[model samples]
Target: MVRELFNSIAKRYDLVNRLTTLGLDKRWRRKACEIALTYVDVKKPRILDVACGTGDMIMCMRKRLERRGIPAKFYGLDCSERMLEIAKKKVPFAELKVGNAEEILFPDGSFDLVSVAFGLRNFSDREKAIGEIHRVLKRRGILLILEFSRSESLLGKLTWFYTRSVVPIIGGILTGNREAYNHLWRSIETFPSPEELSMEFEKRGFKVLTMEWFFPRIAFVMVLEKV
Candidate 1:
């Protein structure tokens, strides 16, 4: 069901993101990549970007690597081939595949760094997926996760209302799938909080080393290291 939902909106994923965020998403993606880079040296980082829909985050990081003539061994994976097809265009130089995160096929310790941006909320078995992340990452490899956090401030409250309601309406009009947008909004509400995420990572032998906030209200980028 989720696969069909994402496939249905593959063509408009980029547009909906920009329109719904009012153009702030590009900066957000850049910040996500920036957060990912901090845990690993960018000159030659082996990155695995799971649930990499449309590949904006991978492309964002690749551009940073291009400045110094360093290339990233970036792999972008998603469950929806339709989305992967769209991502291929966005990240032409990187590997893009329709694959499940809970059963990553790579050999153990295959990647030096792993990251997921705004997609963890959709996982049906987040714990299993985290285990897969732990298994595929090299010992002490970095895990960069950019996810939605709760914002209790008045500004945050207002933003939340708009994001939950207005964003979906606009997204529905643009993509003809209001329910999909609503599901995205609901995912935020159901996702684990920062504290919960830290505890979960630690329970699975990962250490939370960096927790960054773009806004105190809800969105954050947390960087961890596999133990």
Candidate 2:
């Protein structure tokens, strides 16, 4: 269902992101990549981006590393073929594959860093997907997740109102698919809080390095190291 929704919106995915996040998604992706950069130990790191829609995360990471003259190999995997199609054009140098996150096709301990940006909640089995991520990461490897969190504060509540109400309306008008955006909103509502997610990571054998909110506290970045 999620894959089909993404495939349906593949053409307008980037545009919708720009409109909904007010162009902050790029900044958020940069923050995630910057945080992951500190934990990367290899000169040519093996980076795997799961659910890498339109290759935004891959492109962000590559650009950051390249600016610092750090060489790295990039791979992107997503269940949506149309999304991968767009991603391939965006990052032609990176390897893009169509695959499920809950059952990653890579070998165990094959990656120095694994990233998923706003994609974890779309997974049907998040714990299993996280476990697969842990299995593919090398010892001391880092896992980066940039996802929506359940809001509680006053400011967060305002942001939640925008996300729950405004985003879907704008998305539907632009993409002509209101239901897809509805699914997105519902997913965010049901997603675990940052604290709960950190505990889940700990249970999966990851040492939670940092779990910090960016702004409005509606979205957060979680960094974990494989122990």
Candidate 3:
């Protein structure tokens, strides 16, 4: 279901994201990459992006690393072929493949860093995916997750209302797929809080390095290190 929904919106995925999030999605991706950069000590790091829709995260990380003259190899995995098609064009240099996060097709300790931006909630088995990520990351390697969070503040309530009621309408008007946007709200509504998600990672032998919340605390970027 998630794969089909993404495939349906692959053409307008970037545009709808920009419109609904007011382009802050790009900033969030950049922020995640920046956090990943700080912990990277290797001369040439190997990075893998799981559920790398349209390769936005890969592109952001590549550009930032290039600016600092840090060379790195990139790989991307996504379940939707249509989304991968768009991602290939965006990050042509990266090795992009069609695969599931729960069963990543990589050798043990294959990556220095693994990133999933706004994609964790869509995973059918998040815990399994976390274990697979842990299996593929070298000791002390980084895993960055940027995802929506449930907040109780007043601003958070307003943001929730907008996401639940207004976002679907805008997305429907733009993409002609209101059900897909509805699933977006449902996913965010049911996803675990930042604290809860951190605990999940911790249980999987990951130590939380940082938990940074965006405006209104409706979303967050979590940096974890495999222990």
Candidate 4:
């Protein structure tokens, strides 16, 4: 279901993101990459990005690494082929595979860093997916996640309303698929809170390092380290 939904909207996925987030997602992705880069060794860092829609995270990290004169390997995994196809164009240097997040197909301790953006909430098995992420990371490896969380402030509430109403409509008009956009809103509303996600990370042998809200409290970036 999720794969089909993403495939349906793959053509306009980036557009919908820009429309929904008002282009602030690029800033958030940069921050996520920056946080992940802190733990990455400049010599030869191996990075994995799960559900890496359009490879924005990979591109962000790649640009940052290039600026610092560092060499790195990046792998992107996503279930949707169309999304991966688009990602391939954006990240020609990345090795992208069509794979499941719950069962990352890498050897143990294969990556120095792992990151996911706006994709966790759609996972059918969040715990298994997180465990797979932990399994693939080297000891003390860093994991960065960017996700939407329900906010309590008035501005957040207003933003939520706008997203709930506008996201599906704009997405539907662009993609000719309203149901997919509806699922997007529903998933965000049903996703667990930050406190709960922190506990989930701890259960999967990750210690919460830092958590910060961005985009007017509509979304968050979480940094965790494998214990």
Backbone N/Cα/C clashes per model: 3, 0, 0, 0
Stretches > 4 Å off in candidate 4: none
**86-181 per-residue lDDT for model 2 (tens digits):** 998999999989999999999999999999999999999988998999999999999999998877899899999999899999999999999999
Tell me the deviation in Å of residue 205 in model 2: 0.8
Greater TM-score among 1 and 2 belongs to 2
Candidate topping lDDT: 3
lDDT at 166 for candidate 4?
Answer: 87
Over 4 Å off, model 3: none
After TM-score superposition, the amount by which residue 62's alpha carbon in candidate 2 deviates from its true location, in angstroms, is 0.5
- Candidate 2 Cα deviation (angstroms), residue 103: 0.8
Residue pairs of candidate 2 with colliding backbone atoms: none
Lowest summed lDDT over 10 consecutive residues: which window, candidate 2?
210-219
lDDT of 3 by residue, 1-227 (tens): 99999999889999999999998888888887898789888889999999999999999999999999989999999999999999989999999999999999999999999999989999999989999999999999999999997789888899999999999999999999999999999999999899899999999999999989888667799999999
lDDT of 1 by residue, 137-177 (tens): 99989998888866777877877898898988988999899
Which ranking of candidates, highest lDDT first? 3, 2, 4, 1
Q: Which stretches of candidate 2 lie above 4 Å from their native place? A: none
Model 2 has a clash total of: 0
TM-score of each: 0.95, 0.98, 0.98, 0.97
Q: Rate the local accuracy (lDDT) of all candidates.
A: 0.84, 0.91, 0.93, 0.90
